[model samples]
Target: MNPSFAQASPQALVAGDPDQGAVLDAALAPLRAEFGTVDLVVERMDRLGNWAFVIGDMRSPGGGRLDMSGTRFADAAEQGAMSSVYVALLRREGDAAGDASDAATESTAAGAGPAAPAEAAARDQAGLQQEDADPAVAAETPRGRWVVVDFAIGPGDVAWLGWPQEHAAPRALFGF
Candidate 1:
């Protein structure tokens, strides 16, 4: 089953330690690379088996907003001041990934620790819980290093609909 990474508010994100921050940075490297140092605040995170779903807001490094709503894809560089809901599906690093470390170690090395109880919820109440995870997901092949399975940006409703099914991420992302 997947071990959930604690959720944090936009304000709590700036309070983590350097190592923890680095881990997050590493996890988000793909997003940054595609968006060029775009600003993302993780509003929610849920780990289903080895799959993780991240929901957040994205802004430019210059503090301007970027929106990818409606359209399947949009050029971030072309637009400015468009606030958006960012959603990403991430696969956890498994033993097959060649890394012996677990997610917790990555958190520690990145200087990240648990957020304040008042500010962070352990997991999404409406999301699939550990026990409810599909057994097939735990046995899926191609398991390994962390990967950005898929991502969508827009309003929550629209973004959620954009979750891709062809990627390596578990098909049960929405708890199917």
Candidate 2:
């Protein structure tokens, strides 16, 4: 079985708090508008190493809730693989560049909110080149392990994969 095909938890539509809702709505608006209903599922590790903010469809291709523990992204190989997958998916969706920028912008904006320093830092960290500044890049995925796949049905079957790695860490380098 393709390990990458493992399922992930379903993401709930944001609720409560108009402000938070608006932010989420705005953040996701472009995606919804552009993609016409995406099957996005996000799972992040919390301080306790437990999954948090799981979202989207959870059913796997084989039929079962995706086992998050088994979907490993801690290794560089996994991260690189996921990165390539994400880039491909983005290219297919025609919204890769915009997505990357929005992600970085959102992070920086949340951290500093309209400050030059923050914006500049975000730009640098995002690894965006002059060619990437075009809005069209949003339609193309970054040249990495990012993959995109069409699952054919079930709560936005499209997915963008990413694995966070810091400085090519040893755990990921030697396949620990």
Candidate 3:
């Protein structure tokens, strides 16, 4: 749902091709470097709407169950606003920026805090595998956890690309 305006009706968000000329890569670059283990997806807010997009991250590799939903952006302005928010978040989360993309992606709780014993061990092991990368980058790429860092969109074509948010509802973002 968009935070800036009430949803006029029940509209579903669909996945979009970030590679298909969407102007989000730059805003998302920092997040891409920080959360390297997940695939970040941008989706149209609905099959008919064209004024908004939503951002979500898939912790799964290639594909998996347990659909994840991300935040909503009412327009390109909102997308830019969220990008700044994410950059700050990435920094607060001990941002990393090297070789994290090589790590395996997996689903994790949206509100996960410190790792449990089992999760900690797994993160430690994954960290070890990334010994060749910067210690900070490897150390911060928690195994099975991710967050939305940024988002954007292109001209709406009404095709449900099945971006991450398509599988479920989304969170209101930026209050506009």
Q: Which residue ranges in model 3 land beyond 4 Å of their true spot?
A: 1-22, 45-54, 64-175
Give the alpha carbon lDDT tens digit for every residue of 95-129 in model 1. 44344325444554576643333222222222212
Residue 24 of model 3 has an lDDT of 35
Clash counts for all predictions: 6, 27, 4
TM-score sort, best first = 1, 3, 2
Candidate 3 per-residue C-alpha lDDT over 1-176 given as tens digits, one digit per residue, 9 for 90 to 100: 21222344424433353222222333344445544444445433222111223344333356542122342333443444222222111111222343333332212223333333344334433432211111222122322212222232222332223321221212232222
What TM-score, to 2 decimals, does candidate 2 have?
0.21
Candidate 2 root-mean-square deviation in Å: 15.7
Consecutive 10-residue window with the lowest summed lDDT within model 3: 84-93
Order of all candidates by lDDT, from best down to worst? 1, 3, 2
Can you write out model 2's per-residue Cα lDDT over 1-176, one digit (the tens) per residue? 11111123322324452222322332333334433444334332111011012223333345553323333332433344323111111101113343344564565446533224334333433443211121232322232211111111222223322211211111211112
The global Cα lDDT (0 to 1) of model 3 is 0.29
- Please give the TM-score that candidate 3 achieves against the real structure: 0.22
Residue 138 Cα positional deviation in candidate 3, in Å, after optimal superposition: 23
C-alpha lDDT of residue 38 in model 1 = 73
Best by TM-score: 1
Instruction: Give each prediction's root-mean-square deviation over alpha carbons.
Output: 13.0, 15.7, 17.7
